[model samples]
Target: MQVSNRIAIAWPLATTAMHERVDALRQGGEDVIDLSIAISHFPAPLPVRQAVAAALREPRLPYTAVGGAPELRAALAAKLRGENGIAATPAHVIATNGAKQAVYEALYVMTDPGERVIVLRPHWPAYAATARLLGLETVLVDQPDVIDAAFLATLPAARVLVVNNPHNPTGKVLTAGELAAVRDWLRATGTACLVDESYEKLVFDAVHLSLAACPDWEALGIVTVFSASQSHAMMGWRAGFAVAPQAWVSAMSTLQGPITAAVPALTQVAAAAAFGIGAVSELLADYRVRRDMVVALFAPVAWAAVAAPAAGPYLWCDIRALTFDTQGFAELLLQRYRVALMPGEALGCPGFIRIGFIADDEATLRRGVGAIITLGDSMARAAGGHACSA
Candidate 1:
């Protein structure tokens, strides 16, 4: 049997593929330290676990509405209004398996196959991959240090713009001014917006602001997606939801029904519990320490430049001085040093790599960093020796 032409050209997401490779090696008894993706060392918050426990005690779990149980939707609406400053109601909300589903459905409902979608460079892989799968043209622009009106003016008009707050890998949180500029640009261009706030609760120094928090969100056609995977350390739970106009939510729900009906009942329960708990201070504190430690470790190394991010669990390291073929560097590091990390090529920027410092214990994290430095130093030395001999 032959695969469909659409999927035949596509490969597994680089981030997930690398993590799976590490898993395979570990299962074979190899000691591989994985920093391929952000998988928190901490477990889900106490309340979420407790909520799932209580739900399990019920006699039976029945199917609810396609979007979510009424109660769950209502609770999520409250979360949007209170925490995110987005005025939402149950009709404006739809529960999803995770943020990825929300993103796919939003793009599907918001644009036609031939329409264009604007994505910033060094984006989460799914944004481009999903757009491609939908047969939509993806316009990738280099993300600027600041997103002001002048910068937004340079972008071409498109059907949709994807925004990631407390962004992945880089952890650049959009400032209020930047968000206002984007909102104005959307209003001016008549382009819809999809904002992913999966890392909202992981902010270290900067504040995470929702793009759709303004009064004109509904008119602007902005859909905001949230996930408990990173915020609550509920990666396996796959609990997430989206806030959109009622009609868009209805359309997304119609689409979600056939693909994967309402999110699991227990997940809805866990989501409600997780979102209601607000910021997880303890988790934030731990991640901050780890982030600083990794940044400090890379400071003395001349070949790598790693900075402390204001938010999120990953550290972005630039090693262009050593080599631009980060894909090969990552592969060799995994094979020879038994450590795994995400190459910047996967995130649309070569000569860089993303290191997730939130997964293993302190010792393991230190060891992984040491291995990376050792490999990079060796490569630098070999290059120097070759140059002198020539």
Candidate 2:
């Protein structure tokens, strides 16, 4: 017997390798600064902590309803309705281990083996990888400098579209007009969308748009998935929920029952608490400051080009001037400077890198950015002289 062909598919390796290298360096007491994964350094809200502790002492630690505890689901539904302008009820929500699970489940329910799913570029690798895992082909559309009829024409044939708003890697928050265009396309094409709003509360520019909030979303088939992990700094808690039409939610609930049974009783309680008070404005302010700091720090890196992100906590840097592809650049940067940032190849784009600003404190950010800038200089000199490798 051999491993399943499905399991054998090649996933992104550069980012994972960088992570492992960072871990090894940390274990060896090296002063490595990690900017790869989008982990938050901010503290979780006080109420959430208290709730988790209280949940531990509750009498019944048994499995909960597959969707979630009714109170938690209802709380999330209320949050969605009020904040996202989506008309949702408890019956339309399905809680999962995290948005990661919710997204996978939605794709599983919607996709067939050889059908195509559309994904936007400079995206989270999981969106494409998961589609491939289910044997669904991924049709990638690079974020156009301008959306046009020609570009929009490329979308309709795909069975499902995966959208990450306040988009990952690039941190681009979609405008109202852009969201409207996508909504119109989906409605016209009869395509379904899996909307990942993981960073909804972290928007620093333009408002976040929820396709689920579109007036005719149920008619267009939208599945909006969200996580408490990013907003509340509850990464380890793995609490998330999805809002969709009642029938789709019901199917997800049933499909989810046997997978993990249900999200833990304790996690659900804590997440419910998190949703009750909401993402802290103080944390959002801090992240925005760091985002600005990172952009400012990279301003002098002559060999790198980056745009200030409009939302989320990343600076997407284009390093094509460095004379190496992203995989090589990431490996070399980690080895030479002890700086760990994600290669854009992991997100389906080469010659770019995503630097997450939220994980590092101000001092760490300064040092890491300085290292990258210095490395850029070295790379520039090498480009004019000789080939370089790490």
Residues 273-303, model 1: lDDT tens digits = 9999988999999999899988888888888
The whole-model C-alpha lDDT of candidate 2 against the native structure comes to 0.82
Q: Looking at model 1, report the run of 10 residues with the lowest lDDT sum.
A: 381-390
How well is each residue in 313-332 modelled by candidate 2, as lDDT tens digits? 67889888775487787777
What's the TM-score of each model vs. the native?
Answer: 0.98, 0.94
Give per-residue lDDT, candidate 1, residue 167. 91
Residue 72's lDDT in candidate 1 = 93
The segments of candidate 1 whose C-alpha lies over 4 angstroms from its true place after superposition are 385-390
Worst 10 residues of 2 by lDDT: 381-390
